[model samples]
Target: MSTEYKGPLSVETRKIAKDELREDDNSRAQALRQMRDWIEKNPKIISCRTDDSFLLRFLRFKKFSVPMAQEAMERYILLRQTVKIAFHNLDHTLPKMAHLIDNGYLFAVPGRDKLGRRWIIGRPGVFDPYKFINEDMCRVHGIVYETLMEDEENQVRGFVHYADGAGVSLPYLTLFTPKEAVRIVKNGERTLPMRHKEVHVINVPSSLKYVLDWGMTLISDKIKKRVKIYTTAEEAANNLDVSMLPKEYGGTIPMSEMIESFKKELVASRQQLMDNDNMEVRLELFSVQAKEGAVSALKSGNQSCNPYKTDVLTGSFRKLEVD
Candidate 1:
């Protein structure tokens, strides 16, 4: 089959898609058409981009299963409507958001890794938990994730996270309640279309080891197995290429330059981020009977529990599995 529709895919990535995702020109075109038709028929989805690029993210993530992709699209829309803190007001020009970007709290590195996965480095330790709440951090993460999703390469190859935990103190750890942590994990695994490959945590203090152990309980088993903890940056460098990393970790490029470039990218994509707010779930569009059915479906499908309700503090942390 002619694979011209697979635009700009490297030979390795093209092979990965063909072998692993069961993708080809014929299947890709068919899946895109099916998804667009499904979106047009669904009343709850008020607006969405039905373009090939936008629809393909869900298609590839679900391995070309139209039904699964449809369900994932619904969950993605519902997440935006319900999670106002993270989804709403995604303007990069906002003072708080700009401040976060300027400080380089979280951003994707410019290039892909050896396996073609994108690298996202987060320096949460640099931010003040007292000044910015956990929700603020979530908003920043949401923006970065949304921005990264625009790239076809990232969607195809997946992502790796390097979490610099050098400066995280007890206060920073306290910012995340058990329920909040659970919600974050659920959203990443269920709502988002991105594939998470690995998470490398470096520079963790001995005092904070227990906190890391507790966090391990909340993630899904697949992600739990992917998590690798390293005592120093040198150890992590052995796994991740230093050339793609900033000079702070012995890379060639200076960290300041990388931060500046990332900030510029966010500013350039500000309008696109703002446009996401237009696509939402409009329950009012449905009839009374339809509305009730829709509400029931949303409640049943939602993986996140009530934010206000705290998880019971049994001696052990709650284990939330990924689907």
Candidate 2:
């Protein structure tokens, strides 16, 4: 909202980040491909880009429709508030306004000495962000990100953390991918045990129908099998089957049953994907929200709402300028 954040995703910052990343020889082609596709598909984004003051207008739009956008952005600033703390994606330093995604690196510091729990820290090349990427170490990585809000007393340190399972990192190319493609090619799929059964459907069957269909809509038939893309529940109720539904099918063909079966398939597929996925690969920028919306809603009213409560959320420290 302030002028300082006029456009967190501006060209200058992106240019700078890209150049730095190149120094490490990382391939940004994947991200560029996805960004193009996303912009091309979302007319709103295209129109926003045409304006010289796109950043300001975009923030306002988000404030109106989603107050959280501002919060997320602010949190990002705090996340990198100081050089004392920083985020890392692999060995490459995180870039400004970088969308969090699966495979996106996270850096933090867990308190040391007595406060240190049973887990390990500072193992060289062991996804151990605490040892490096800290306020004191960020400079060594060629990153001068914000300084610790106040590191005069180095008591503030990192905690366990990682990108949201939904985090995404835009390869330098700024490519955009449809949600479905993201779950597939970029994130990959997981197959079920072929035995897990008994699913229950409670939401709008029509909506579920739509999401599952994305697999077939964007995917050509040739490689669909490898991706496990399909219509309706095969052995289950077959919601994808309009041909077999009776004249009274819409009102009669046990639509509820189909939803249940389809749910089973989806749950298992994602579980398979989850098993193979690196916690980072499962998250993307806005992916925390992007990934948790549905699951949260389901558990919101239930007793299992705290998704990351027990999961190891690694924490890291950065230098800041807090008053």
Candidate 3:
């Protein structure tokens, strides 16, 4: 369930979306007040600023369940602390990130899909492991964060992703391991607020399928059900609106134009990304220490997670379900 509002939503649409998420301006304001008060009263368990917007983002993601949202917020803080490569020191000025943006390696295309979900496309081939370290995963998070911010105020239904692994060369394949793939996918699925409508993977060579399948094992069955693999771009195009895709994928828009447009978005959002990177999530605020090895793992850029230990919310109100 997503709305196609590109800008300030109509009052009716906003109300519906908020109700669907079990929040309204007044309800959200009250919840934020209560959460902030709780945080101040019990500063040890969690540390959060009174950033209403930040709190509300998570609240919306959790359907305004104060307890659930609080837990999610805390988990997000720990995730950031634990996954340094994808969360630490992100800035738009990074040369590698800039190159990725310019080369169409990672980008969200302008406009929505036929169903109104946003379209985010990534080309792993555009990444040069020699120049771009695996730690650049943090930069990918930064880009995704900016994309979320872009549509935060609007009523968004969900997201649809297109991942092209056709460019996976033998050397590139060697550097890209299943472990790192699991790390990236886990961070995204567990932490991000967006509902992924589906993921269509195009140009999947036999060599890359094993890594892709292994990574899928790490994600929830719900997400796994939404993933579709096509041996060629043409077959994938049949399942999506070609008019909304770029020419490279048999769409109307040219690849050069898409890249240039995406570059502008990156430039426009650069400062915001830099600010978010430095924003504090004080995991040590709790009397107990941060995760035992999180600090060291983060420092050495060796982020990993026990896929089975992830938090799974259970209830009738859970908006996104596996089936």
Candidate 4:
């Protein structure tokens, strides 16, 4: 069976992974050494697979500050523990994950934004909240974890969650449980290793406004600031590069092809995802005080978390309607 759709669609998105680093940019090489040294010297505080690429992921997220990167890595693992989702036995081959893959509500777009952040689309088509299982959501989270592991070059600057609520029925909004909603918000907003550049909720039906507000209340003010509601696809595309987005968001590539390619990529990277299982924090090594320190490290706002201070786009979430 063919893995990718090979029509006249622009292959630009498919080729985004081949970004070249500048010759003068020795910062990463330097960061790699410092991070390794830090890990070796402080084995008690940090214990994970010492993969160079794995270490670099945290270093890049922390902007190469050795101490800060160490803290971020520890905090990430601890946060995974705190969330208590499918961190330990996250197998993509599970029945629930397979169901989610078949449904394809969420998947990362092949292309990156202008700033190099991955553009992930969440098109929860025909949402039946009664049918929206939490494990299905966890499957999405596992895919994201898989994505971060495979991003060795640190080319993924951040992420944009474009939630296409176009086809969601009103009942989904009302029926979604607060517990499930809180779990989704806490993990997706606070704990994920990458920066959340933006969240665009498009094509929101008028009847579900109250449900939307209740869901929004669960979203932290920091993340809620990034949430945007749009009446039309055109309005939503303004915040994203249309060419990078699939046809669902007024882009050129067929959504079916984009999703197929994503599935192929996921299958191709299965081994790397398994490798990541070793890299998760072994919480038993750290003392209670150490764990508290790691959690506090996450709250320090050292890396991409403080995008506004780091000179990223500065703006609060907005509600828009295009006539």
lDDT of each: 0.76, 0.25, 0.64, 0.59
Candidate 1, residues 1-323, lDDT tens digits: the string is: 23236576777887898888888888988888778778888978879877666788898899999999998887787777677678777877778888987777888777676888878889888788778887888788888888888777777899988889877766665556554565666668767899888888898878778666766765678898999988899998887778878888868887778888877778777788888888877866645543222322124445343322243422123332212
Q: For candidate 3, list the clashing residue pairs, or say none.
A: 2-157, 86-138, 222-322
Candidate with the greatest TM-score versus the true structure: 1
Error of 3 at 159 (Å): 1.3
Q: 2 or 4: which has the higher lDDT? A: 4
The number of residue pairs in model 1 that clash at the backbone is: 0
State each candidate's clash count: 0, 78, 3, 0
Per-residue CA lDDT of model 2 for 36-61, tens digit only, reads 34444542221212221222222221
Question: Looking at model 1, which ten-residue stretch has the lowest summed lDDT?
Answer: 314-323
Candidates ranked by lDDT: 1, 3, 4, 2
Which of 1 and 3 is ahead in TM-score? 1
* TM-score for predicted model 2 compared with the true structure: 0.18
Question: Pick by lDDT: which candidate is best?
Answer: 1
Residue 143 lDDT in candidate 2: 21
Off by over 4 Å in 4: 1-26, 41-47, 81-84, 113-115, 125-132, 153-156, 167-187, 205-226, 238-240, 280-323
